[model samples]
Target: MTSSLFYHVSGDGQPLVWLHGWGVNGSIFLPTVTQLSQYRSYCVDLPGFGDSQPQPGTIDDWAELLIAQLPANAIWLGWSLGGLVATRIAQRWPQKIRGLITIASSPCFMAQTTPPWPGIAATVLQQFTQQLEQDLQRTVERFMALQAMGSNSARDDIRHIKELVLSKPLPNATALAQGLEMLQQTDLRQELPHIALPWLRFWGKLDGLVPRRVSTLLPQTPQSQDIILPGASHAPFISHPEDFLHHLRDWLQTTNKGV
Candidate 1:
């Protein structure tokens, strides 16, 4: 397997690959994945974050690298930026990726009114991109705060996410910059309707970023449905992990029955 990025495999059952949000590593899912004993989890650090040290590249570059390291027919689950990457992987290699799960993510992240879209304002991300060049810590801290904002346990969520970010090697400015660029320019809504594989869209009712409204606006796929978790924010798994797991297991069971 490729050793370019850091990854861990645990438990034993159907394979599950987890990709984390920007600014943090895959270990952020440890608390919840550890409880998903039914899945043979493969949690990996995306390039430029955690122990993974490689030049930051485009979304296609990311998908090719990650898919090469995992088994075929495995389920892919991504959060925020990671979700975008996973979606690309499923599109690029539909045979390898059997199912898709996205949390707090949107195909078109840049908000626009021309096509009637819901997403992040261009100015806010523009500011973050500018600030990333100056102070990586402050910029990431601010982004983290934005993520935890609007959650019922907003204060506690920020503190916990901070601890996770601090525990690993921070992603370089270039990585953060490139990630923001992807968030600003990428749009996959036009492609969602074409994918034939199963997809589950997870959302937070209180999310400040990637508003729950985006799911409704997404092009509906044949095997896709959106599950909005009440009282959860940007990080639904972090806010209510057990509830998250409950839904996941139930869905997996339902999916397997058809197989």
Candidate 2:
């Protein structure tokens, strides 16, 4: 109900909903959305990011909010935090999701009792949260830079992300704080089995945030597909736009007749 959850719907054909990573909004996928203009695309702002304001509920509730807005049985694509949200949507409402595409996202972003194959150490998240609490603005700047670690264009990517992040500005301190908490506490390993929709997982080899090895942690399903992008960072759509779009188009064509 909050206008803070802003979205830009473009293109024509079946909806391609994009969810962005933490600390950023749907704009992170702007390159993809622009290139894939032939397909109906909806880039959404997670609660607290972009124009979306903080809401009272868990991350599952945030998924529900997106589901509520989506056209019936729309195609869903999420990156990092967005991927986690998409997974939750599939679990909660399998019938409404036509397919799932996760970009540089995994079932578990942080290690748990079961231990995700390759995920950020719990200590890293804890330190980030601590620093963020201590200095939200500075922490966000550092996080933007961290997204492109180990990349040739790391500096440019960081600058671009910083510009994008600052353009909209964070909604409120409460939402930002709560969203960070959600990111740290969320673990969807147990819920992955409940997803019955066709699913696709993507990873960026150079992504320091969600390491490529995280791809191995995904639960094997009958209708699941996985792709790994070489020489790509956390934001592959930006780093490898052509390859990313090509693969995306091919997957859409093969899967649902580009429905």
Candidate 3:
């Protein structure tokens, strides 16, 4: 087993595993986690991304491996690519998850015949992928910049994201390529109906990565709720901590009778 898959645990209550986005480790959720003192928080660094070692299989294999590393049942909070991981968890093993909260994520990142909000063009993704192949370090920097784009706190947020990425030494090239490939091919629209747990979907209204309208793709259930963070970009957990915590706490209360 790779050490990169290791998790950092803190706080106390029902378990809450934090799954970070691509190009980053678990520290990306620090702001939100600070506010979630009531839950036992376990922040997982994706295989090959932080202390974890690279997995030798498909994305599903990696996801399964990661899932196995967690507690039997817990609330999953995933961001960006981590959200995709969370989606697969709730879809394939709903009984193992108490609830799900996805922030700045979309069911499908790649554009579809029916697009979810406007996402980066295929050509743009390809270009970035190519850049990643040439220089993984610069690629991460570029990705972090894109994540912070249009935010008033762009400078600090990007810096924090950079620090998060650097906290764990840069992931190897193969892992970076695989991550981007997963982003390109993953489509979660049809699988949305399989999720049975309460889902809270959070979005930054100004997110350039995941379109705000993509929230509609998920299966509608009485337990599912969608919220938009105004003037926030893709990283609402950092850019709008207060609002993020407000909605998250409210959702926790409404669903589990208070956290």
Candidate 4:
């Protein structure tokens, strides 16, 4: 990992790393940091977003880069695309992960027929990829709008997401393209069953990008748990931070007792 991949560490308790979703930076987790202040938290600007410089590679490569920087044996909380990266790290470096939490994330972000996993249509993703090439700013804006589509407080959610994105430097265009490609091509369904760490998956009932139907297909291990927020959308942490944090704290206290 390069020194340019910026991260901020705060609080003073069990270590927790917060990974933001696509098109945004570590600042996306500002609400999370405030609510989950009991734990030592590392909020990272994934390579290419915010102050971090871009590094081109596959999902696995991105995971490796992050793994190099992250503290050992820390709880990882990833949102959207960051979830996929977190899963990759857990799969490859199991000993480094204490627990795994995925918010509004899916194993397979693009739809599949044989397994019937709910996801975005490939063509729609392609359209976003194409649009991104022409107008990076507008494409990101459209994506932010889509994230807030199904929330009960859609207007507020949209405004909140927009404000966060604008708060940081605009994400690198190359990084945006790479993230869309990862969403389209990366599939971890087969690997899900092998992850041995305690796993908690959070879903938004009204999420448009990652359909709630995918939750039904998650691995059923003793260590695995799934929660779907009613009337919440893709960005539940932004839209329903209280409910999100409530469940998160409960899970941390119960599932990861010693952490």
Candidates in order have lDDT scores of: 0.85, 0.78, 0.82, 0.88
lDDT per residue (tens digit) for residues 1-259 in model 1: 4438788788888999999888888878888888988889988888888888665568887788888877888899999999999998888899887799999988888899997898898999999888888889888888888888888888998898888767888886777887888898888877877778888889999998888999888767668878999999999888878888889888888876766
Candidate 4 per-residue C-alpha lDDT over 179-220 given as tens digits, one digit per residue, 9 for 90 to 100: 988999999888888999999999999999999888887878
Clashing pairs in model 3, backbone N/Cα/C closer than 3 A: 3-51, 3-52, 4-51, 4-52, 4-53, 5-52
Mark the regions of model 1 whose C-alpha exceeds 4 Å error after superposition: 1-3
| Model 2 lDDT, full chain set | 0.78
Candidate 4 ranges with C-alpha deviation above 4 Å: 1-3
Best candidate according to lDDT: 4
Q: Any residue pairs clashing in model 4, and if so which?
A: none
After best superposition, candidate 3 residue 108: deviation in angstroms? 0.8
- The model with the greatest TM-score is 4
- Return the TM-score for candidate 4, rounded to 2 decimals: 0.97
Model 1: lDDT of residue 63: 84
TM-score of each prediction: 0.96, 0.92, 0.94, 0.97
Q: Residue-wise lDDT of candidate 2 within 1-259, one digit each (tens)?
A: 5434688788998788888877787777776787877789988887777787667788877877788767877888988878888888888888887999999887667755543256787798788778876888787777778888876677787887777667787646676666666677787877787787778887888888888876666677877888888888888777777888888888887877644
Off by over 4 Å in 2: 1-4, 113-116
* Per-model RMSD to reference: 1.6, 2.0, 1.9, 1.2
Ranking by TM-score: 4, 1, 3, 2
